[model samples]
Target: MKRQAYRPILITDASRSQDDQLTSRQRRYVMMMGVRVACVIVGAALVGTRAPLLWLWLPLVALGMLLVPWLAVLLANDRPPKDRHRLANRFRAGQQTDAPAMSLTAEERPHKVIDGEP
Candidate 1:
């Protein structure tokens, strides 16, 4: 039988929640701007006869386009940089666990051992 080696797991901090939130907010901002731009273009095309009315929507479309980048930066800055290990441990504690296991595995491990030592 081959002996399966069990090594100690070194868990590092990763802010998954913050990352997810940032991604979600970015998607929303992009979608919002896309929709607003499409609406403005379509509205202008449809109301070609009403020049003044169609022009009125341009400011809103411009504002939406301008706000996308600003809001993305704002939301990204708002997220606090927290220690991932501590955060995960806190979550595990709420679930009645002592220590949260780190997700790192041998395959995904980046550090290399030289001369038969770590």
Candidate 2:
């Protein structure tokens, strides 16, 4: 008998709470920035140690000093990626309604013409 993979079923919305997602992203940003700051300190140390290849170490130092902050800030400010499968401008959240969804384009697929309206 062939064994099938155990796939756990879960709803998209139930997968994560908004606050959890936000806090996780925030943690990632802080950790990455910390690493970037460490790069600068390490680069400075390398240059101070006068590692025979000053030429190589200098660029590393400059890169750590310059690019790291810019990238760190960009990542920190980055928003979560959009879900392509989800629709846009469908309806406002927390909406309550007893009726089923009514099709806005119920006029017919080919679009029939009325006698009075041109």
| Residue 56, candidate 1: C-alpha displacement in angstroms | 3.2
* Local accuracy of candidate 2 as per-residue lDDT tens digits, 1-118: 2333444433862335678767877887788778777877877787788778888877877777687677767766766776654333334467643222332334422366679966
Q: For all the candidates, what are their Cα RMSDs to the real structure? A: 11.5, 14.4
Q: Which stretches of candidate 2 lie over 4 Å from their true place?
A: 1-17, 87-118
1-118: candidate 1 lDDT, tens digit per residue: 2333444555544346766877777777677667667756766664776656656676665676576567656754565566665556556644775322444456654577678765
- Give the TM-score (vs. native) of candidate 2: 0.54
Off by over 4 Å in 1: 1-19, 43-52, 80-118
TM-score of each: 0.33, 0.54
The candidate that achieves the highest TM-score relative to the unseen native structure:
2
TM-score of 1: 0.33
Quick one: how many clashes does candidate 1 have? Answer: 2
